[model samples]
Target: MAETILALEGATKRFGGVPAVRAMDLTVERGTITGFLGPNGAGKTTSLRMSLGIILPDEGRARLFGKAPNARTLDRVGFLPEERGIYKKMVAEDAVTFFGRLKGMPAGKARQRAGEMLERVGLGDARKKKIKEMSKGMAQKVQIAAALVHDPEFIILDEPFSGLDPVNQKVLESMIRAENQAGKTILFSTHVMEHAERLCDRIVLIAKGRKVFDGTVNEALGTVPRRVLIETGEGPDAAPVLAAHGAVTDDGMTGEGTHRYTLDLAPGSDAQDALKALVDAGVRLARFEPVRAHLHEAFVHLVESAEREPA
Candidate 1:
């Protein structure tokens, strides 16, 4: 069995009599890239803070590497907070080196790693530039470099892609893949589903401060019903025929006098079967294509379902 890197049992937190997170259980296995995903204000940050022992949970407990988090254990972890900050006047390399030193790296080695990290993050030219002199995206990368310079075994990133442009986001994604390939366990929180879909080996989804789903990408995607798109020449008989195969909904018109409808295939039903049924019924087909489920769709489905449950 894979070792557990981080675990939370019945973790809960609240502020001003309002719950921020409630009875959450999560685990990240060693050597895997885990994605902590949710919308804004979904208690993701609170949960992460609790996991790192930066903030104590009001109830339950968090175990880091099978023990409570402390200076010794925390030293082996790298964290990039949702709120980014650094010495505005410190040069980029010096800023990264400062964080490395904080993590107990020797001064000379810290400086050396700082330079290498800055260069790896595409900020080598900006190494001599002060944080105040850099753009928002550039400064964010500097903080990322700092978090990673010490080469910690476990990495936790919260909202790491929030401010970057597409190009820089891609750069960060590449860095994450490279780190995991180098045998680091990673957990990152993001509202962007595409990033999680592309990078995570497993995903934990939170909504309204509670976990809604935890599983592999394929398992999550399975929550969304199988669907297919079918277009037929505005015929009254088509809707009835389509409904026999699965739940049918009218999609907006595609072209002149052509209507599009989404058919959610029933359990034990197949798209090919639906297509054949439509053909057998002599429905004039304009288009017939299977609709693939996506992580974003699954996220919405799970979250919305959770929201409707009694609190």
Candidate 2:
């Protein structure tokens, strides 16, 4: 059984009489990576902040480890807020140590951890340099290291990949994966579907401040119809056989002597039947493959469907 760590009960928040988040409820189990996904102005960040207790919600409640979001719970959790802010005048290493101590870490231990982190991020030589001297990527690594200094069991990272280069992005990816492997429950939010798809064990998709989809990537992908690309040595007439099995999207473009078409299956479609029909139609098959759809397609489908509905 999964150990429950973070949860929200009727979590709601507003700004100046405008409802930002509406009774949001979610559970992030311990020792798993949870991805928070949504488009811009979708209240992903606002909901996260309310959950972090950095901003009190106008309504609802957020609990960390069966307790309210308070200093005690805060100490046991690592957070990299969406809004990044740090002291520019302090040396890179010292700044890390200061933040670490604030989270109840011993000064000497925090300093040692800071040194190790700086080294891991390839900034060991720049430890004495002020934050202003470090590049944006280096500063970002500092932010990440600060979050891990106290070895919190739960991590909440909001757009932790923003402004990072591909190399730094990979570095953070490995770190997140490692943390999860070490039994740290993490809830990471990002607009980049590729990272969320590959990194998260399960996804909590949000739209307009409400949960749109909550499940594994496979579950969400299953909600959409599969598009199968079929290439045959026969011809366009094969469409008749393909459609006899399922609806197709081919436009009679079977050549310049080429036989290629597409089939779109309805929900709960049995793709094998369609393949069998094509084979039985005497169309010598050259290539037949299911078009792999990821989180992006499923997300777009849900968001567009929602928009098409009445406001």
Candidate 3:
């Protein structure tokens, strides 16, 4: 049995009697990275806020460390809200130290930890830099350092990658992996599927304020049809053999005499088997590629399915 770090039972919230999150259930286990994923206005932020006791759920409950959230329990958690809150006038180190002190660290220890955190986040030279003086990416990193300065047992980052350039996004991803490797449990909410697909051990997807799926990345991928791209001579038409494999569609010609086709592998069928069938049919091959389903595709597929369901 896994040790659960956080659990939500029918956790729900509303604004002006309009539900933003409805009967959402979630569990984040110890020492694992969980992704709380959804599109904009899908209630991810609402759910996270409710989980941390920052906002009360209209109905249902939230538990942290097997008990109702309280100051002592919250002390063991570090959080970065989706909205940035660092003070523009404060120096980078001072901001981080301030957060550490708020978490109960002594002044001396908090200052020391702040220095270490700033250095760890690549802001050693920026320790004295004011938040207003740093680039958006640098300021974001400073906030991240502040969140970790307390060295909490669990960390919740709400859209940590939002607004970061591609390079900085990769940097944040690496930092996340490093922290998880240090045995800290993490739960991050993101509308971006690429980040979750690469970093999560398990993912919980929300749409329209309700959870629609909960599983590993592979399981999520399985929700959509497996796709493969095949290329061959225009003759013999790979369609005949591919039709038996799954849904086949022409992908347009690639060159003067070569054509491309897409195949959605049938249930329990293998791509290799389909390729073999194409070869056995004497189809001249130019290119044969297996296209793996991305988490974005799975996210879209699941959300659309939920929409189709009669509410």
Candidate 4:
């Protein structure tokens, strides 16, 4: 219910009948970091284009701050596309400053800000060198500076970590967190779920041009069945007996008198049934508890569910 910073209503795009995005609808609230995640070929780039006003949706609409993709709205947003570009011959500092000037920042002020940002991003030493002379990580730092130099209210980054090494990745992650804390809205698209898990306040997942899931990590994972790992007495393949009323993953005895079994909760499954099952299986049950799935497990469960849906 927070004020919407970006909204797409029934937005659709196509590359000659092969739909890139199909009737997708999503909203990003002001000052929130919302993640866009998907596997390869999931239409992440096309959705980003509509969000940034580069290409109008062939069907439906995209709005930024209640206005159609126009100069005013565009000026208020920073974009780092999946495919990045920088003048290879231009020094890193000059290139970023030039982009700021195009956005109406005065040249002198732009240069000052460029210098500050380079230092902040740890590329101050390479600021005077041509982009082609720098390593991929160094060049990427310059590109991020260019995207953020204008200090736009909303930032959209597409695959910003593709070329970054681990050290650079950590550096960029810190920068992103700092900016978010400063109250800038961010919509970052990545194939990497771990990044989203670490950085986003909320998440929107798309697959094959359709939305498969949208919400917080906790909310997304809430649908998975709660599980329990129990180590008890002894039983020879207790799966069928225990699973008769629920779901069972495995069963085995550890040490003497210690039996371990993985239980999958059935719909309306009574957990007490687990202890009873083990007790009746001639195993003296010793442990009982539910284990919640991790973020990776939840993500796999959701995506697998989405794959079963009809196109």
Q: Which candidate should be chosen as best, given lDDT against the real structure?
A: 1
lDDT tens digits, residue span 108-175, model 3: 99999999988887889999999999999899999999899989999999999977889879988998
By TM-score, how accurate is candidate 3? 0.95
Say which prediction, candidate 3 or candidate 4, comes out ahead on TM-score: 3
Model 4 error, position 21 (Å) = 0.6
Instruction: Write candidate 4's Cα lDDT for 1-311 as tens digits.
Output: 68999999999999988998999998999988998988888888999899878898999999899888888888888888788788999999999998888778998999999998899889888889999998888888899999999888899999999899988888889989999999899999997777888888899988889888889988866767778786655445566666765677666557665767788778787678766776777765667777867656766777778888888
Tens digits of per-residue lDDT, candidate 1, 240-300, equal 8878788999877775778888999888888888888888888888889898999999999
Candidate 1: segments with Cα more than 4 A from true spot:
234-236
lDDT of candidate 2 over 1-311, digit per residue (tens): 88789888888887988887778888999889999998888888998887878888787888888888899998999888877676889898998898889998888999998898788777899899998988888888888878887889999999999989998898889989988999889999998888998898899887877777889999988877788888777543678787765677665446565667888886666678888877776777877888888889988887777667653
- Per-candidate Cα lDDT values, in order, are 0.93, 0.84, 0.92, 0.85
Q: After superposition, how far is residue 202 of candidate 1 from its true place, in Å?
A: 0.3
Query: In model 4, which range of ten residues has the least summed lDDT?
Result: 232-241
For each candidate, give its TM-score against the true structure.
Answer: 0.97, 0.92, 0.95, 0.89
Worst 10 residues of 3 by lDDT: 251-260
Off by over 4 Å in 3: none
Q: How many residue pairs clash in each candidate?
A: 0, 0, 0, 1
Ranking by TM-score: 1, 3, 2, 4
Question: What local lDDT score does residue 30 receive in model 1, on the 0 to 100 scale?
Answer: 96
Q: List the residue pairs that clash in candidate 4.
A: 232-259
